[model samples]
Target: MKAPYIFNIQKFSVHDGPGIRTTIFFKGCPIRCLWCHNPESQKYNQEVMLTSEGEEEIVGQHYTIEQIVKKVQSDQIFYDQSGGGVTFSGGEVMTQPIDYIVELASRIKRLGISLMIDTCGVAPVENYQKILPYADGFLYDLKFINSQDHFKYVGKDNSLVKDNLKFISDNGGAIYLRLILLKGINDSMDTMEKTVEWLKENNIKISEIDLLPYHDFGRDKYNRLGRKCTQNFEVPDEQHVLNIKYYLQQEGYNVKIGG
Candidate 1:
């Protein structure tokens, strides 16, 4: 009878995984990445935001597992048709109690719906292992392979991220490594090369490397919250993104932008 605290649920989402999905955005995160697109999700507690309709709305709503499953199962026909399923996203879904994720995912899988998790991999190794079985695919975020650099930009070390990725790879699961290419940050040639080398060395064979060019999509959210905009947020140009794509391609890796 456990109910999770969820911030939002987006239906007909295509970018999260292999098919059209209903993405459940959970309400918490452990790290404070400066370039966060979903600032509302960063806080472990609920926060209110003003909608364009000029109404105040809280970020999270409590939902029982049965209730959410009912909503998701309503789209079972679409899930079957589009090869889509339920995707548990977040500030970081694993940040929630592991039992909740496991229970929800187990139910989703039982109904033959593909389950996915979009995570930054900052949680404990045991946490990652807990949900790995129920997920059909994972959009794994690899912000910075270099631990120090990771802590500086992402406000946490990269050890857990790396370790969880290695564990996922070892378990023969479907994992997509997402790299956010921020200008003057981790977008340098050395960082990219080193990251590529590190992944290969760890025996992690990602089917595709999604090079996400940094942008200021979250700036307005910060403004809405009356918070200061993150200074020096850099979005790389087309040439820069293309160059990184080519570099990874040359390394025999399939590369795409903004996956």
Candidate 2:
């Protein structure tokens, strides 16, 4: 496979996974999440955008697997010291070049560097199967239990997501569930109840659950990219977020507030 366009290489990211880690943010996503903070990650090709300060910027760069491995290799010491490694985030890492992802994962494992795929969970099951052995865990995002809501907000069918999640869990891959909470859309108690029911029904094994509340942090980026900044989603209140977390905790889940 040829080189792939990656949007960002964020170093020392603590929230993506365990410990301080380097995060590989690839360009291009399968879903168009309304509250996505990284608007630059939505497109596959390189493009120019105006920054907040009105500065012109070009996003996306082609990177070879060897160059990326070398970059992450520099952080090996940090990974060893802090239980931190590399997180392959996106755009949607799973939907990117599978050959690149598989090869990079193999190299990362060969180097003994821990690997995690922060995914939106909308890719083929075979993609998950390819990296199952190399990945330490997955940061799997579950946006909505309702198919309509998922398609309306996220712009795709979620059956594939659910199927892939179950596939990963059943295949013995560690799953760190990420729940995106949009007030009045998917942050209701009914949704939570059904979520618990779904998890129980499928027997999904989750190492942890991250409750990600809605935020308009990337609203301005839309304007910079010459796109609409639609504020269709509202941020879940503090107590509401806590309530969801509390309810999930009651359901015997290892739940946390953020990813």
**Alpha-carbon RMSD, each predicted model:** 1.6, 1.1
Question: Any runs in candidate 1 off by more than 4 Å, and if so which?
Answer: none
State residue 135's C-alpha deviation in candidate 1, in Å: 0.9
Q: Summing lDDT over every window of 10 consecutive residues in candidate 1, give the lowest-scoring window.
A: 223-232
Task: Show the colliding residue pairs in model 1.
Answer: none
Worst 10 residues of 2 by lDDT: 227-236
The true-versus-predicted C-alpha distance at residue 245 of model 2, in Å, is 1.3
Query: How much does candidate 2 score in TM-score?
Result: 0.97
lDDT of 1 by residue, 103-135 (tens): 989999999999988999988888778888888
Q: Model 2, range 49-128, lDDT digits (tens) per residue?
A: 89789999899998888899999999899999999999999898888889888999999999999999999998888889
> Backbone collision count in every prediction?
0, 0
Give all TM-scores, in the order shown.
0.94, 0.97
lDDT of 1 at 106: 96
By TM-score, the best candidate is 2
lDDT of each: 0.85, 0.90
